[model samples]
Target: MVIINVLKIVNWFRVTNSADLRKYDFSEELTQMKVMKLLYYVQGLYLKLYDERAFDNDILAWRWGPAIQEVHDKYIGQREIVGEISEQDLADFKEVNSDERLAEIVEAVNEAMGNMSASDLVRKTHEERPWKETEQSDVIADDLIKDFFDKNFKVSRE
Candidate 1:
């Protein structure tokens, strides 16, 4: 079962990025690396929290970190995602955000690591087993992500 829709999640980030810039006063817009890393963390956290895979898409271990090819392809040649969120994009984001659990997972990930730089997220993922063990360009298995998060991830309610 496809628990998470990758495009919807991406739209969520795009929409949220705009809001976050104002809410948090972020100087830089979300880059591709930052979005990918956030997606990876959301997938891992969802797996740990729900004992299920978030999305059906395979996450590849790229030179930077875990990356979804679809995302990379979409944002290729873009330095930072800076644009108006279209009506369709906003609707798609609303669809994703309607799922309370999934929205919470996304919110938690953003709150925890959204402020971190792309390089910081890359370094953090590189230290994790899924990225470290998977060969470059190979898919980082969901089971590996689940296992690693089960052992290493700690939930905080604050």
Candidate 2:
């Protein structure tokens, strides 16, 4: 019989400590964590949206090794899969080709990168959420959030 620890496995985060990722000058550390967390969430959402066992499971530009030799792979390219995200696809998203099955995955990746410069700006400012219940002198935060959403989405049907 196999056993599993549901509590320990839930909401688990895979950590990546690349020195290359840390080199960029940060205005605040928490801001950087926020963007990276969003990226992580988006990737998880992508995997959830796709069926890993179906034939012709195209993973777009997700990267994995040529040999199916590792358990810890990008997964999209491991089983019932083909191709990872390429450099050109990373720089220019117009190259990504998809069908109905991959629709959500592509959309999530786009959302992850969309208005990304703003997130980068947020990172550079180093402003973090206050730990205490304190009022802010700047009353424009509400406006800023609204503007951020509006500028990013092409259509707000909701």
Structural similarity to truth (TM-score) of each candidate: 0.92, 0.23
Native-vs-model 1 lDDT?
0.87
Candidate 2 residue lDDT tens string, 1-158 = 11111111111111111221365554222222233323333333333433121111211211210111111233322221112334443333222222333334435544544334434533522332211111332222322323333344343222
Model 2: residues with Cα > 4 Å off, grouped in runs = 1-42, 51-95, 118-158
**Model 2, TM vs. native:** 0.23
RMSD of each: 1.7, 16.0
Write one digit per residue (lDDT tens) for candidate 1, span 25-117: 545698888999999999999889888766677899999999999988888999797478899889978988888888889888988897899
Model 1 residue 148 CA deviation in Å: 0.6
Against the reference, the lDDT scores of all candidates come to 0.87, 0.28
